[model samples]
Target: MSSIANTDEPAAATAQGHGHSASTLTLAVGAVGVVFGDIGTSPLYAFRETFAAHHGAIGITPDAEHIHGVLSLVFWSMMMVVTVKYVLTIMRADNKGEGGSLALLALIRRASDNRRWTAPLILLGVFATALFYGDSMITPAISVLSATEGLQYIVPGFKPWIVPTAVAILFGLFAIQSRGSGKVGKLFGPIMLTYFGMLATLGVMHLSANPAIILETINPINALRFFQADGFTAFIALGSVVLAVTGAEALYADMGHFGRKPIGLSWLTFVFPALMLNYMGQGAMILSASSPAAAAALVKDPFFLMIPDLVRVPVIILALLATIIASQAVISGAFSLTQQAIQLGFIPRMEIRHTSASAAGQIYIPTINWGLMVMVILLVLFFQSSTNLAAAYGIAVTGAMFIDTLLLAAVLFSLWRWPVWKALPLVAAFLIVDVAYFGANLIKVPQGGWVPLLIGFVIFTLLTTWSRGRELMRASMSESALPIEIFAKSAQNSATRVAGTAVFMASTNTGVPSALLHNIKHNKVLHERILILTVAVQDVPYLESIERYSCKDLGNGFYRVTIRCGFLEETDVPALLRTLDLCGAPFDMMHTSFFLSRQTLLASAKPGMAIWREKLFAWMLRNAASAMEFFRLPTNRVVELGSQVEI
Candidate 1:
């Protein structure tokens, strides 16, 4: 604790900047594929759900006024929620070229300089991340089902195979996660480009055929009239309309992967136009129908039905591929967020495998991959259709969006110190939009909206428990810490000095590590050169290599080393050790032995946590992947010393 300083500004990593080596245009293309995938695929179902959500619970007649109004809502929802809040405003609040709830939280934490008020903000960020898991599971389920449902148009018998086909597609999607997103993203970029091209082409064809509604769809007055004419019904319809902008928050979340400019550029210059065009096309196609029956039939599934009969099958196949790409993006995002959670101590350390040598952000976590696969399959099986799963969507996305607004307020007002006049109006607009969407979605609780809320609660509990448990565990561990100076001097005279250098891993730099203490007490031997090492994960995404480690001499062949790395960077202790020439010589694998302390947690009624939560913490501790593996230590040279901690 003494060695660790609460710095207001962290030496953030440049990995993201390094990743920008590709031209911005190239990056924008990649962003089109991955960052916009979730939102891009919304056209497959957003329009259909808007007219006929909850089994016609929000059935609005597709007349000229209503058609223009729904189109207005979809267009403006994208404008306000996606372009205004996220692209123009919130994306500016990046943490060293990274953006997301956690990234934003870390930014605010540093900006606040460890103020107590940031605690609530931290919880909000963690809860938003928790809700992301629900989104991660639902996105794949709904996207796949919606795209595959187009099968019913090709072959009426395809209705029965819809769920099973979705399930199989989902299985294969998750199965391929280990292969990494880099190659897949390159492949996806071109396909998604083609998909968006198709979207714009279809929309333009309809837009020209019925140019009557084109001007009306973009008018704010039309959107307002929908609320005025329909009132509560329009509000209820908002729950479905929000499906149109479902991936708005995720676009901000994924800023780290592609940088803000590329994602923002792709959204504005490409994805946004394509999506709006498609929505307008759907609306124009439905509105200009020859009769009411024809309009209603178009309303059923305008996305596929509007496609020319000849190209419909190819478009369906393309839509399926696009949906798979969408699922991959969400799945990859979960992996990246999990890495941040582990580094920030919100979740226990798990095995994180790097999938690409060039991209540091590209990673794969087996536990998360498998857990998401199981949940998605169950959701597809239970819901049985995209419409049912649609009932469970939007809520999580809205809840997370609202949380981001609160976090953004902190950034605008406190971090950036924007004036009252400037920040107030901006925040108020965000709140009104966020509250409206969140409130509309809340009305869907009984209709399966509870699924995401339940998932968020469970995940929030787990994240908080692990965080609190670690605090208590560290407090308990630190109480018995002996100073390194005292231990080094005393051990020098008492223990027989061995030949090789020994590295003791300590969670806190202030303490003589438990493993070091146990070793001397039992074996009564010490390495000629002893290094007490602490690897600190900073809040930023990357750190400069020159500022990587700090070495302090404790005399008597003793040295203290602290390695500082950004949370988003993977730590390889062995590789880091190779770069350190702490005591007149570079660390060699042949002469180095690594020591690790493994804690056995005892869940006691000790007032620190609830009994059940304590047990959960203990279970998590036991199941957490080993420090040896997480730190990428050589298994052959590592020694594990067990110690018990009661909290």
Candidate 2:
């Protein structure tokens, strides 16, 4: 197996400045829009779901004490999960400047030296990524559905159109993805900013009427009393309480886009305050209602109930736009994650289209986009309501969060090198909360939670199969490969020499590429100058241009070149070759012949993998993007040599 050593040094500081300047404020505003959308929209259904007795779990009483208890739980859950765990702790464990389950996994692996522990950590990371796919699908379905359900409040007669309207909105959102997010992304910050402002305003307006509710909410005693008084019911209520922090991971995952400072500032100064006020406002509204039944009905749609009737229509319109923005963030995240997976060798390459010339991160993946659209649409159709979809929501997120806790423990003791005393308490707190939430969500599996779990499991299988398959394929190829020294010694005397350059793509630096061997054997000639090129994706997000390529000259007109890139970088062989100084001169497309190997995988009774998995891997390999396109080789000058391999 090939492994890249992880660097212990901190990632080079980001070039994007986050100093106390106007640029920093601008980035912070942008961060508010993209980073907090999912959690920001939680007020729509989180409160309502907590009291929903349909699951035979928790019963809601609109008395002051019960209202205070639920509000305290929501407030504390956000503080613990979103603020303490994500904002303060996990975000600090970035890989270079990138944050995500995979990125964190890379960072931890780089820091640890124990080979025995690598497999389990990788499995944890892959499962976390798989769970993210489930979250990506559910976020859009639930966000848009919850936002559109507002139509029922505005016009009771329009209730029947909720599902259809949500479907139309979601379809439209996915349809425009191919064109790219650059154009629409400009408005996300402003729209979300306005949405949060509205949220805080509505909450403050209601909070002013019942000021005592805010005090009760801030006190931790109410939350303790809630668990003590209700016992098992309170524990079940945690399943719904988790909804308030559903999108907390996005804050950390998106840290690479906006630096930690901007994201952290945005969360503390704006997102956190706004979400608290809104949840508090809903609680206050419920407590101040005329009757228990009225409070119950009001909580069903408390987000809209808090808005004044005069501005109800505009608020619903704003809510729909906000949900769309939230959905956009999740969709874009999926694209970014898929690209990372491909670069890290967890999945096969797919066609990646850059939507914006200036932004390297702005990309569109058609397969993921369309696949997500289908799954999201089906989720909407199946659940038929945001409340129903809520049943399926927490499992994927909590599963991922649970995985993150495990990964974080590795980072704490292994990577960060925190002494056991300090790290243990922090890890324990995170684990306790993560496990509590995950265990609570497990109760929902029979109802609808199985959807995300099944999706995660299937995706996890595909990821592992592809990863293992690639490793086995490489081993098989290596077994047959000729050493560069041995090949050069024999070929110099045996083959006829021709003019011009021939570059053969190789998976490893030590072996002769199959394409090179095939060309010399069949064509009976060798280029005067031959280059065996190998591309390596490092664990980091990017490598500096000055440190990109290394070349070694071998006798008999052969040169071995290795190009290194970070996981977030695009690997364009042609582009990197243009900057090459050590390999004769800079490459000229007309003079260069790019030779690629197209492997035809066959499912054999090999010990490497199950026959079914081998077939699945073969199918994925067959459908992957062609090397000529992926490596940006000149189409007319490229030649593909086909070969069969069994694993």
Best by lDDT: 1
**Model 1 spans > 4 angstroms off:** 1-9, 12-19, 53-58
lDDT of 2 by residue, 374-444 (tens): 99999999999998999999999999999998999888888778999999999899889999999989999
- Report per-prediction Cα RMSD to one decimal: 2.1, 2.4
Q: Residue 35 lDDT in model 1?
A: 83
Clashes found in each candidate (C-alpha, N, C closer than 3 A): 3, 0
lDDT of 1 at 178: 93
Q: Determine the C-alpha RMSD for candidate 1 after optimal superposition of all C-alphas.
A: 2.1
Which parts of model 2 have CA positions greater than 4 angstroms off?
A: 1-22
- Measured against the true structure, the TM-scores of the candidates, in listed sequence, are 0.97, 0.96
